[model samples]
Target: MSREYKNVISQIFKYLAISLVFMVFGFFVGQRFIPQEYIYYANRIIAILGVLFVLLAIFSRKRIIPSRFSMNYVYLFTFIDGILMYPLFQYYLYDLGIGLFVSIVLGTAVLFGVLSMVSSRKSGGYYLGLGNILFAGLVGLLVLGLINIFFGGARFNLVISAISLLIFTGYILYDISLIKYSVENRFIKDKNDLSIHVLNLYLDFINILLNLLNIASYLDD
Candidate 1:
């Protein structure tokens, strides 16, 4: 691999490590002492940090060439997402069944992985061709699914989760491929741009993982 590729890989690893640390810390705190209500707020705080990290990544991109800080944002977002999902997953796992949750999450991850590979080779043709169409469909599905959820329905939720896993997984692959290409092409020449890409990819990965985890937990239940 090229130096840039190596750098990117290293950055990913670093971020993953940092995320694990935070996840562990958060888990312990929540399990040991934090009240349920406070835990919810804590998760929100982490989420807010995630948003701030994204903003910083964007602003930083405009000022300097890409650096390690760019990758740091990716790790930050991953940690935040992991933290938020812990409690949410705990709450929903009992109702969803583990097998179903796993199926959904894995399905989503696979979808994104395939789409990312396609998007990379086609130079966004996938985005223009099928990506937008899928995105619109997903939005419509989400709306309908929300309605179903509100009406005390399970079918819509299952359908939506299944479809979402597919759609979002494609998104994950596309987003990650874009990030890799940007780094390779030198479009991400500054810290901010790099950070933005990292953050985007990190979010994509976390979403995929969380969805899969939810599916798995649901199936088990």
Candidate 2:
């Protein structure tokens, strides 16, 4: 591999590793230290902060903030994301029981690993062109999710979960393709670019896992 490609790859992996650590720390803090009474309040506060961080990252990408500070945005968001994961994780952990929860998690991990490998291949570029389609799917999924929230049907919720699972599964390939393309073309000129790539992959993985958990929970029920 070219030196540029190698450097970008290394940085991406480093940032992802650190993001995972931050998330794990947040998860542990939420699960073990935060009291039940405050969980609701904490989630609300953290969620607002998360939106602010996301906007900051978007602004940085758009050159509103210095690109060098993008790493901070990515780290902060990931840490907050871990806290977000806690409630969902806890719900599934209890609702699905330990065995099913573990099974779904393992399944998601395996799927993520396989998709990453596929995205690393020569044909990875094919997925790079799928951003628009995948994004449209996500938007549709959100609409359906909001509708399901109001209408409230088990089958409808399951359908939303399944669709989300597919959309995010596509996102995994799309995002990895983006990383590869940007790295190879030297489009990753600053920390903002790097952070965006890492965050995309991280979000893709998290969504896929959550969707899998949701689907599995519905099936188990």
Candidate 3:
């Protein structure tokens, strides 16, 4: 890998590690410290704050807000992501047991590692052109998800989970490929850009894990 490519990857992973720490901390606090009576309310508040921060970061990117704080907004949004995921993870861990949970987590990690490696190759740009296609798949998944919420079935959920797994896994490749492309083309101009890359990876990892868990759960049912 070129030095710049390596540096960009290193910075992205460094920020990813920090985000994971906050994720774990948030999960721990949600599971162990928050009172049962307040858990619902806490999640609501966290979700709202997550949306607000995301908008703030977007606006900052558009120059509506000072760009200097955009990276901070990204980090803060990631911390909220963890907390927002707490209740869902708790439900799965409790309903399906730790064995399934651990297996899904390991599966996600392995898949992420493999895809990242593939995207780090010199020819990674092959995946770079997939951004628009993968995004369309993602949008389709969201529409299917909402439709299922009203006309839901275990089988429907399984199908969505299966499709979503493929899409998000594809995203891992695309995001990593973009990282390599960005470095080679000098597109990553600043720390804020780096933080956005990290956020994309973070979301990809989280979604993969969630979809894997959903698939396993549906299959078991």
lDDT of 3 at 168: 71
- Model 2, poorest ten-residue lDDT window? 42-51
lDDT of 2 at 129: 70
Task: Report the candidate with higher lDDT, 2 versus 3.
Answer: 3
Model 1, CA-based lDDT: 0.51
Query: What's every prediction's RMSD, in angstroms?
Result: 6.7, 4.5, 4.6
In model 1, where do residues sit more than 4 Å from their true spots?
1-6, 33-80, 91-130
User: 1-221, model 3: which lDDT tens digit per residue?
Assistant: 88888887888888887888888777876677555554344323422333343344334324565423466666677667666667767767765799989988888889898989987884647696776777667666666766665565667767876787787788788878877887778778778778767767777787778767767766676
Candidate with maximal lDDT: 3
Measured with C-alpha atoms, the lDDT of residue 127 in candidate 2 is 90
Best by TM-score: 3
The residue pairs that clash in candidate 2, if any, are none
Q: Tell me each candidate's TM-score.
A: 0.58, 0.79, 0.81
What C-alpha lDDT does candidate 2 achieve relative to the native structure? 0.68
Per-candidate local distance difference test: 0.51, 0.68, 0.69
Candidate with the larger lDDT of 1 and 2: 2
Q: Model 3 residue 100 lDDT?
A: 80
Clashes of each: 37, 0, 0
